[model samples]
Target: MRPGIHPASRPVVFRDRAAGTLFLIPSTATASKTIEWEDGNTYPLIDVEISSASHPFSTGTARVVDAAGRIERFERRYGRRPAPSRG
Candidate 1:
């Protein structure tokens, strides 16, 4: 709750370059560039490479690893050894 010690938080526009999306949110981060929002107001613009729009998890485009296939390949490459007899 300190007044002067905290960085000023203001409305800033974050532009996802890859997704071509813009989001207006309050942040302490500053930027040299500015952008005109839909409301006809100019705000500090921050360019980002990845966002929810383009992320694999968010878009459901993530690749599913096949553990069974990998195990089969490994067993084929190196033959499976016999289990030791329990004394």
Candidate 2:
């Protein structure tokens, strides 16, 4: 319970440019622009390039790397090392 130690957090509108989505959340970030939300209130407007709505992992559009296949291919190309003999 210190006084003025933490940054002030307020409701700010974060707009995802790629997905064209808007989110109203409390943030310590600042913005020069302003916007009127659906609730008929004006809040700070923060434009973002991407968000969970447009991210590949969230949208299930990300490619899953085949590690095993890659290892097999690498072994096939550059032969596997022989087992070391115990002294």
Q: Judged by TM-score, which candidate is best?
A: 1
Per-residue lDDT of candidate 2, residues 18-76 (tens digit): 99999999999999999999999999999999899899999999999999999899999
Compute the lDDT of residue 42 as modeled in candidate 1. 97
Over 1-87, each residue of candidate 1 has an lDDT whose tens digit, in order, gives 978999999999999899999999999998999999999999999999999988899999999999999989999999887889999
Work out the TM-score per prediction. Answer: 0.82, 0.76
How accurate locally is residue 28 in candidate 1, as Cα lDDT from 0 to 100?
Answer: 100
Model 2 backbone overlap count? 0
* Candidate 1 backbone collisions, by pair: none
Candidate 1 versus the native: TM-score? 0.82
